[model samples]
Target: MSNEFNDEFVKEIPDHVRQRLDQTYEKIRFQSKKKKKHNIWMRMTAAACCLLIVGIASTSEPVKAAISGIFKFNDSGIEQAVNAGFAEETDQSATNENVRITLDSYFSDYNKIGFSFQLLFEDPTLLSGKVEWISLDVRLKNGDGEYIVEFIPDTKPLYGKSDYSVGVHVMNPIIEQKTGIAQFDTVFDSTEGNFPALSNAVIEVESINVQYANGEFKKIDGEWNLPLNKAAKPFEVVEYVARESDKIKIVKANGNPTSLSLTISIDGEPTETPFAIMKVVDEQGIEYEAGSTNMTVKKGYTLISTTFPISSFVHAEKLQLIVGNEEVELTKTND
Candidate 1:
């Protein structure tokens, strides 16, 4: 039985079937080897694709190393974006290590109300610097699609401690109402001051130019006129008198008996002093001897006289007398 089993196993297979089996085995082996090679190639391709993606991302929008940044307004978010475009353009234009630019109100809106900007930049080098000059162009448009006014800075080159002329341009050639020019100084880091020193730097508004759509620009020429002095009239002393005599004598008789001879001095306002009658009062309640005849002041008496305007005395409530450093109150009498 073992010999018979051996003989059956050793029997030759049909040619067609043998050939088909051989072909099927070879195809299976080729497919397995091809799959292994394909897997390796796929992994390499994936790794290459990842490296290319990383390289593109790194070079696309490279980060900038800015040395100094200048912000003009309190809210400069929008202005910063607009300036970014300028900066990009400038970056392509020049090759400098340091750059500075002054920004003015004309860059933003037509209202002539915008913050000024000053920028300082440093390149990644020891040499080669750049400076960019920028300013706003303000123009007002009317309903007729015509510019009512075109405002621009003057042609004077901006320099340190130099005045720049600013004004408006008209469509017409006529020059009329042009504003004056104001000069101001620009502060830099080398000014030997603190951070706030730059802030205190003044921007003088020199001349203002106004233009009409009809092409007419007028140069309004005039110094800044100050308002007239309308200050309220200061307090004025209408009447002042110093009594030095110990024995009070009434030389003049008015309707009231309290009249006495007084030396008067006045200060302030321009007016004629009205005739005033004076009165004499003693420590004891005693009236001085005076007849119906109006007594004239005794001669050889030291009587100093001065006059003041009526407006000065209008607000005086009471008249006080200082005799020997003693203040004496006097009653007001109708004269």
Candidate 2:
């Protein structure tokens, strides 16, 4: 069985693709300590990285057909929202220092905003060889000169930081397979609370730094402030009777129909934090899980909230919350 499994799967992966995967893993391992929590890194590897490798390596016709023509580097939640007409189609472009940055599109909800961007280089050979990583300094502001979001580091795992206005966490940018064009998505989530009704918000791109496999670096220094329209849509909230266990209590759930995202918040007296809730299964036993999660303990109460990109669970006849070894039933309020 082991020989057959590897002969069919492992040997099919191209040497170059394998090397790329190894490099990406090493990079993530090196950056994991400084940039992200260990759990977040684990989730990324499990969902994104693993799937990416398999999608690239798999020779099956069905697998190729499944992944073909999709933007390989997008958050599933935001992508679904965009598909459901919950995003702004902004084809705006600004060129600086030989690099053309285009804000291809964006989606915004109560607590987060995501951008899909493309970087085109005049020198087509800019991505000639192994590209290590690409980093962008992005900022968003409202008309009143107030910063809409800013990335914060080392916010506590349980109780989030309260002093900051909006602590935004920027996950690493992903590059598409095409040459001379680096298409990627970046999501900025508010750690403090939900975002306000924004108007006249403009995304500012200060600079972009790219590192190649040769250890040489290329930097683009300039500012591009592109106008953004529309305020974020409020999340659809559903109230529950608040069920409780010894350590955790289920409060309410927030959902977005367009994005197919669900956020479950649990509040109870602080005790041992439950293990990560990785997957959610509905009555039919179909599973879905995607999106970011965080917990907060405020005012002597612990609050754990996680968002998942499950479209069906919003209206599922029966839904269950699975965290660690604890499985709690979720009953919705009557319509």
Candidate 3:
């Protein structure tokens, strides 16, 4: 079971722990805003930092009514979408080495997929101190047992810093001081057209490796393969007019309950500005956060598809898809 804390629970946490959490949160928000919109490192760092906050905060509970719940995303838009039942809920549990891991929630929109996991320790003292890092050897496959996603951590140093690696798609989990339960989220890389049908998908976690603050390491190896009951709910393709620039044309811009996908056709020569790095803004000039992004070169024009966390556009009368300096007007036909 997980400990539930209220908004006032921060005061109960140790001063040092609270300070560290605040600092880490600030760092994550700053990096997320300053980096490229499609950078995967930002997502990984944000997830780890969020887990750190939750793990440490769960240690001290000031006697509140416990409620069942999972973690939340830092993005307000995505959080709202999740709250509105945009994600698939599940409670599949698997135990190994006295530790229980539960797959609580999952969501996918073809372009991107994300899921949350909760770990409960039988011996709470195992997570009594700051946990430096936790790595899970995770792989995903379709119903036919064909591998779809594999996390291969980079081995070489990234610009003389080995603590973090670049080009790694796995969202590594981080742990801090906690009592028993720790929850975290993971978003896979942009699948583009490579993602197979989501029906009956199986997620296998071969092992989980943990590194503690005191230079201690722990590895829990087991065969944990969980099956999904169905495929992700398909995104509703909102009506829109194709808009084009001298450099590119917006052929497809669709919206789902939690995300927006934009596909653009690059004209003759590639523009100096990369579409994947551009900001995704709505009609109100509000910029949404980017998820997984991929670019492909076709026979004539290059195709770039990037997903943004914009909640939904079903109710909106007028919307805009702004990528860099280019803006595409999207008018909802049924409106």
Candidate 4:
């Protein structure tokens, strides 16, 4: 792993890490005027940060736990998703000059989608720490090369030790050697977006703008495409009581065996916001976290779909949902 830390220049952290943290922080800082309707997770975020800093001083274990807590998914989480039938994973590559970009694979559901890529440079030195994206864009195109749905990507660099692991985990970056390639990951919503629904479409890379460490700017552009399809299969949502008036139903389970989750739709009175699902524990005592979730305000109910990844495929059954302020156990039985 690359032990490199940006000790002098603070430019070490890629922008998305800071940007998203700020966005999530500001989001909960001023969520609602009424104390009753206050977001539980957002309210706890600050304390979590404090705990993280304190943990860093005490032990690395707590720091690691705190850092991993930033997102609902991790490497193991991705493995679980793959086991659960992670949609159509397509690979394609494009090259310009000495730089070659390969579209690796992707994960998706009806409401959300995520994909990763490996950028390979013939001359690795050309890639620098100072590089900045002028813009990173992705969109869906048709057979005749027509624009369909434009995905406003939320981007991140997975390979380097950056602020995401540091600020959140408060640890050094997990750097591997400078292999010939660098991994880049990004995700965007499907339903809430203004763009039309993505059905049988090709996911393509529009452009990537970069500013090098030495002040040189480069924009690697391409039309790298991957075939994407909706992969979540609807299941008979088990009606489980979360609160006095609220009920949660496991709606759909994506079929990817390596990576899978039981989708849930929670409905109740207007006062209901949504449950803050902390973890999903199995019969074997393995606890999994919520990976990706989507919610919409319909005429009658707030339809929410949450995907929880168990440790593995065999560990997916006989599960319990750890949700809300009071952790309610929602069960999934083979019967």
For candidate 2, lDDT tens digit of each residue in 47-97? 123222122212223211222322223444444555556666666778887
lDDT per model vs. reference: 0.22, 0.49, 0.53, 0.40
Q: Per-residue lDDT for 160-215 in model 3, tens only?
A: 21111111122223242444655555655341323445878888777676656665
Alpha-carbon deviation at 123 in model 4, angstroms: 5.8
Model 2 clashing-pair count: 1
Tens-digit lDDT track for model 4 on 207-261? 6544343555565666555555443332222222222224655454442332344
> Could you tell me the lDDT of residue 329 within candidate 1?
52
Quote the lDDT for 306 in model 2.
Answer: 48
Q: Which is the better candidate, 1 or 4, if ranked by TM-score?
A: 4
Q: List model 1 lDDT by residue over 94-177, tens digit each.
A: 112233222322221111112222222233221122101111222223233332222223332222221111111111101111
Report RMSD (Å) for each prediction in the order shown.
Answer: 45.8, 8.5, 8.9, 11.6
Give each model's clash number: 27, 1, 0, 27
| TM-score (all chains, Cα) for each model | 0.15, 0.64, 0.69, 0.51
Best-first order by lDDT: 3, 2, 4, 1
Q: Where does model 4 exceed 4 Å of error?
A: 1-75, 81-91, 105-114, 122-125, 129-136, 140-149, 152-180, 187-201, 211-217, 225-278, 325-335
User: Sorted by TM-score, highest first, which candidate order results?
Assistant: 3, 2, 4, 1
